[model samples]
Target: MSKVFAKRLFDGESWLTNQQVTLSGNVIESIMTVEVPSADAQSVDVLAPGFIDVHVNGGGGALFNHTPTLAALQRMVEVHAQYGTVAMMPTLISDDYEIMSQAHQTVCQALTENMGGILGLHYEGPYLNPVRKGVHNESKLRKPTEGKLADLLDVCRLSKLMVTLAPEQVPEDFIEWLTAEGAIVCIGHSAATYDQARQAVESGAKGFTHLFNAMTPLVSREPGVVGAALQTDKPTWCGLIADGHHVHPATMRVAIAAKGCEHMLLVTDAIQSVGSDEKEMAFLGKKVLRSNGRVTTEDGTLAGSDLDMATAVRNTVSLIGRTEAEALQMASLRPAEFLGIDKEFGRIKVGYRGSLVALTDDFFVEATWIDGQKVWG
Candidate 1:
């Protein structure tokens, strides 16, 4: 067993001070108020549940699409861990069947090895709509076939799979079928109408990817995908890229107000430039550049992002005017709930996993722990 002393701690739901958290193996063993600081306890300024990123394309100079290998995935985990991301779903943008199969096999191997910080695979799609294929290769976009669907089902069987597609572009029963097979279906990169979005949710689409960007906007007359995401009464999650480039602060504020913070989570939608010194990288045979906190193609198409989870949590506070605890929850707890791993990974309770992060006063990550083992500092 191990013990760490937290000067201030956010235990998922509320904040507490001067607490000692004990861990046994990979799980939190106990937590108690510390009337007096123990000299043996490892001290931290601020500790909270580790951030869970559902959408990550690359980091540490590795792009999952470019190099669908175990080494590349490990590099990503190392880079994001410095930013307090204890778990992530490595995302592959629209790609061919061969590359998709390769990526899937790589993730399976990682899972089999019990690699730290690798939660699953997020196939962000070959099944997306071509119209809103931002940075995704248009040539790779296609309708899902029986063979592809079968492969995806196998992926769900092996690990947690999150598939993103356009509701209107897919068959009426595609979302239902995938969800039934244990895949978390999400809507993105489409011009689906409000009704279409609603129907997709009713049919088992659990979330919206990158909430506003690459999706139909909310208009006065016709509520588009954004409208449906905000107005849906079901327990659906919406991923907001709090990077400031993908969404305006005011717009994000309104969306959070409408959807409520419990249903609103943050995603980086990050690419290779994140957590690396590289200012330029290749994306689907095209050159992409990172500058002034934004990553974009030469033609001014917004690619993914250079954002990290720590900065995302910081932005939720500074940009969106949310409390620090709320911002931390969006980064950790809410995403865990969205992925249906909340009971084990989202909190600092005694029975939960000992995945946690400590941050400085500026919200920069000081240390990160995944399953009771310190991974970064």
Candidate 2:
């Protein structure tokens, strides 16, 4: 058993002052108010549930698409943990069948080995519309074949699988079939009309990837995919980048106003540049550069991002005018709830996992603990 005392604690739902949280093995055992923290109780200025990222391409100079190995997974996890991310879904942007299969196998092996901080795999494309396939190799994009669909379903059965696709590019029943087999379907990189987007949601798409980027906008008459995402009342979650570049502050404000804090979440959509000193990298035969906190291709297409989860929370608070609690919830509980692991992973309650992050007053990461074991400081 171990204990951590926090001067300020956000226990997933509300804030409390001067509390001690106890842990046994990997689960939180108890929490109580404390006037004087014990000498042995590891203390922190701020404690909250660890940030959970549902979309991450790479970090620590290890691009999952470039390596797709266990070593790469370890590196990504190590770097993100420093930024307060205790768990993440390593995302593979639109790749060929062979690469996708390799990524799936790699994640399965990681899970079997009980690799810390790996939730599952996020297959971000290959079944996307080329018209809006931001930074994705158009040549790699294709309609889903029967064999490919079956293989993807196998991935779902093995672990938590999130498949992002364009609604118009796949069959009408594709989302339903994938969801039936336990895959989390998300709409992204699509130019689907509002009706098409709504149909995809009704069919089983649970979330929208990187809302307002790489998607049809909410026009006055068309009310495209963006409109569908905003107007839907079907428990669907929308992931905002919150980096001040992928989306405008005013636009993010409007999205929050429309979707409510409960149904909105923050995702870094981060790439290899994050947590690394490298300023340039090659992506799908294109030269990618990181400048001023943004990653863009040579032709000026926004690739991924240089943002991290901690900075995302800060941006949400400072740029979007949200409270610290609201920003933390968007970074933690909302993503956990979207991934269907809220009960175990997103809170500091008695029965929840002892995965938490300690932050400074400005929301910078001071330390991180996963399963009650300190991983970064």
TM-scores, one per candidate:
0.98, 0.98
What lDDT score goes with residue 72 in model 1?
A: 98
Query: Residues 101-133, candidate 2, lDDT per residue (tens digit)?
Result: 889889988888888899999999989999999
The model with the greatest lDDT is 2
Candidate 1: what lDDT?
0.90
lDDT, each prediction: 0.90, 0.91
- By summed lDDT, the worst window of 10 consecutive residues in model 1 runs over 146-155
Which residue pairs come into collision in candidate 2? Answer: none
State the local distance difference test value for candidate 2. 0.91
lDDT of 1 at 267: 90
TM-score of 2: 0.98
